[model samples]
Target: MFYPLKFDHKYIEKVWGGRKFENYREDMPEGKIGESWDISAHESEMSVAVNGKLAGKTLKELAEMYPQQILGKDIEIEEFPLLLKFIDAQAQLSIQVHPDDKYAEKYQGESGKNEAWYVIDADEDAYLIIGTEDCTESEFKKAVQNDQINQYVHKVKVEKGDVFFIKAGLLHAIGAGIMLAEVQQSSDTTYRVYDYGRDRGLQLSKALEVIDFQLQSGKRKGLKVCGEDYDYSYYCLNNKFALDIINIKTEYEASGEEDRFYILTAVEGQGKIIWDEQELELSETESVLIPAYCEEYKIKGNLKLMKSYVPDLEKSKSQILSVVE
Candidate 1:
């Protein structure tokens, strides 16, 4: 079937992820809100354009309409496998963790959450809480009880165009005023640790039950920059199920092959992707999926893109040539 793309909106009741990212504006005259973003928004599950289009349609629509043009040759129809999102942190998000494949199999067999963050925009002092700093179970529990979590987790200053890979079971959160895009395994299971003394009627007992005690026993130093920092490239914090990032003024083209489907997400920029007969234009914080069976795909029009496909650089030359040709 042919490619179907649409723009869907996600309105979360949570106060942190508001609707600033969805309507972002630039400094130039026409640059006014060319890209989609959120200032205080949560649950970046919406804005899914390519695969599950038409604002909550059936899976059959995806299968019959955009089959060869959505997922790849190696994947199955039942395994959508990935969930893409755009998140804006107007305020600090909850310090939380997730369950990996093994843990999820044992505890939540149907749920596995592994996600990565691509920094779309950040303040001069925007910082991120990734993993733990140094806290034993007792100390962590006490900190949680007293609501003093700032001393427990590792924090790092961040900037636009930087990418951090967040694996399942990693304790992390986005600080205030940071906009990001996330790609993950299609599960939304999250365990919140602390929430800055806010009363949402949610208890922390559930989080304590799932928190990993082993990691807290060890110390984790945040990604450090001792001196001046410039536009640093993507440093994969973790690649649990996929690769994620934030790019700038660039383009990526994945020539169709027998391996995997090409997932293209635009964190920032104005660009067009050429896939088979489909010519898709992408703006900031938008995402699209290009199926593998499709013909030679080309990407033009300068933009920052984050791309993920199953890593198969080890394929034989004959097989590689057979597909791209």
Candidate 2:
């Protein structure tokens, strides 16, 4: 019998990282903590169960043991379908691009990356680079050679509660003084175009090969305010996954159908998730994995959460549209 399962954080340090992770966990190492992988099963890093009988087990092991229960009956995902992380960018990240699935499989033996970012907070002047202006291959190459890349790069100012959907092959970068939640395919194949004088070998050749020159610049619009009363919003709903933000007032009930499992992250406030005779005290920045086919559950309290899961696009689309209309 599966209940709500929480996972321990896997902290990673980086040159552009800051100390924002201290708000989520107290045992972080003394260094610039860049990201905390909240729920992951990627080969590079994995999360461990933090509660109940499955405590200490890696997410990979749990999925393998209870495939249909944890990942859904129809989810034939090779490993985990999604990777969730909290990123604290004290400084700018490298301007980079990720190949599509076909390109990645042929060259890197991995899946491609299509990610979404939900800005949790941002400094007064924080911004991001999404893509370049319309330019021919020769024009882009010349800009790179002349160290005038910024001239073609598209920059957009960001603020709290903003969201962006970064498709594969788009040249983009997360700017400094921003903290956000990232959801993406479980791949880490990055081809950097620029690193702002970091001296790290740039993947210029590979990045140029995969870059989508026609992709428009700027970030995606904010989450769609689908439902009335501002109780629900649809952040993203695509072939790979669906994400929704729920604003709980007094109590909210969530169903667990057999086709998909839900990963819920409490982004603000405090609450208790109760199901199957088990209850977990959910705090800010904590996450829980509710297995597929598990009993229905109730979230009680005033809080905000991001819910993600594999989705049947056709059926999910109609369902969402009806609610919004």
Candidate 3:
């Protein structure tokens, strides 16, 4: 009964949110709808199915009910491994850091957070604060206490299609007038170092504890086009997950080889996801979940989207690189 599952939107109000997502869906929360948890199974926020017999069922319940089929084989985690969302930063977000898995489990009793951002839209003046200048531990500590951290923070102008890989323990912030797609660990354990005069809690000590002072510019590997035939790029390929931007002109074939589930979001244009004689229309900003047990599927149409899934790093290297060449 499970084809590709589309879930109802879970919009979150934030101080820095804007009305940008209104273009995609109506009935957004009254206040600043900063985030839309498109596909999540975190206890903090759960996405529920909107179609099929699974309608009204929470993603967490589905994961539990159909573990292997929903999450994939050998994935025995209690909660979903990844959380995907759209972030609309009207004003600047608080400068923050997140712990690694070890630190998070020991202190917060949750998994750590490692995230990436794909700039969906940016205004002419849009930029972000990423990483910081090299500083001594004592100097950095003083800067945080005195609210002079901006002098040490690294800034970068953003453009559409930009990708930034935010590893755990990195001090970063989403600046004003930027909308982005975030792929990250399910955990939301953020340690706030600075809030730019906001009334939010500051975890200077915890943030400093996990902050990587030696971090330079947060520039990650650039996403490169694969080949002439396929207009796709491998944006991120880490142990946790692999993210690829695929532009389907005619048709695209995908096989669930790793026995892992997949999350595909149409970021641009529309298409029909055809699998086993079934078809579902996918439009911009719409996300669909492909079950782990599903066989080969074809995405047909002139569509541009992102494909995300947990990957076997060693096994996928050759296949992933071959597409680039």
Candidate 4:
């Protein structure tokens, strides 16, 4: 049966991780937990269902067995299109870049990554490394070799609710003291350019091939639309995916789209999703998959949710514009 599905958090430990997630969830394992793969179907890490009759099934299995029900009728892709996660950067990350679709398919046999970060919380001094200062390929190469790359990178101060779109080929790094939720195309291919002298290999050759020095990177001030009971913030809309922030004052009613499924993640506060006489609790840092076949649903609570899905560009644009008009 198609119902809202919740998954077990897959915590990944990293050298730069910390116990920051402990503030929001109690299931955090003891260690430097860097990331929680909340909703994913990638080969690197697939999310497992933890609620309803679908309990214990991996996302990949469901996608393969019930593609139409799980991914929607218009989503022709056999694989689940997006990967959602929470990142806690207690320490700085390496400077890196991901390949575009054409390059990735020909070379790495995978989809390109186009990701966006939604800051949930951050220290007063938290920041992020977006693109780099103006420089030629050779000059940027030299800086990396000489450990002078930091001098050429642009750092932006971040605060809660800040959003950044990291398109493929844009160089970036997550600075320390920040915790955020990330939504991206389902791919794990990354080329690290600089690792702060850590004992890790550098992918300079591949990084140079994919880095787009001219690409502009900065905060995304989403278009806001007010609703009777809530506020909607549309952050990104592209062929890859669409992202929106729904701020529920008391409750919100919605229905599944015919073309694609929706992944609703509660980034702040708590709520319950009701549909077909069934309901699921959604608390901070929790995600629920609302399958395309779901006819209707309602979210009730004082909360903020990050909604992501594969999009039909024209249809999505029209839906948002309709409200503005």
Which number leads on TM-score?
A: 4
Candidate 2's displacement at residue 62, Å, is 1.2
- Per-residue lDDT for 42-151 in model 1, tens only? 23433333333343453334535655555556555434566666666777888888877666667666456766677888889999987776677778879877878778
Model 3: per-residue Cα lDDT over 1-325, one tens digit each? 5668888888999999989998777668788889999999988889999877788999989988988878887666756799899999999999999899999999999889988887888999999988887777688788878989888888999987788888897889999999988889898899988888889888988888998977755545655665544587777888777888888877888766446888998887888888778778887788988888766778888888888888878767887677568
Name the candidate, 3 or 4, with the larger TM-score value.
Answer: 4
**Which residue pairs of candidate 3 clash?**
none
**Predicted model with the maximum lDDT:** 4
List where candidate 1 sits over 4 angstroms from the true fold. Answer: 2-7, 22-69, 201-206, 213-240, 244-253, 275-278, 312-325
lDDT of each: 0.58, 0.84, 0.84, 0.91
lDDT of 4 by residue, 17-112 (tens): 999989888899988999999999987888999988889999999999889988999899989989999999999999999999998898889999
What value does the lDDT take at residue 284 in candidate 2?
A: 69
lDDT of 2 at 288: 87
Query: How much does candidate 1 score in TM-score?
Result: 0.73
Error of 3 at 235 (Å): 1.6
Clashes of each: 14, 0, 0, 0
lDDT of 2 by residue, 136-178 (tens): 8789888887888998888989998777888898889999999
Candidate 4: pairs in clash: none
Cα RMSD (Å) per model?
A: 7.6, 2.0, 2.0, 1.2
Give residue 205's lDDT in candidate 4 (0 to 100). Answer: 99
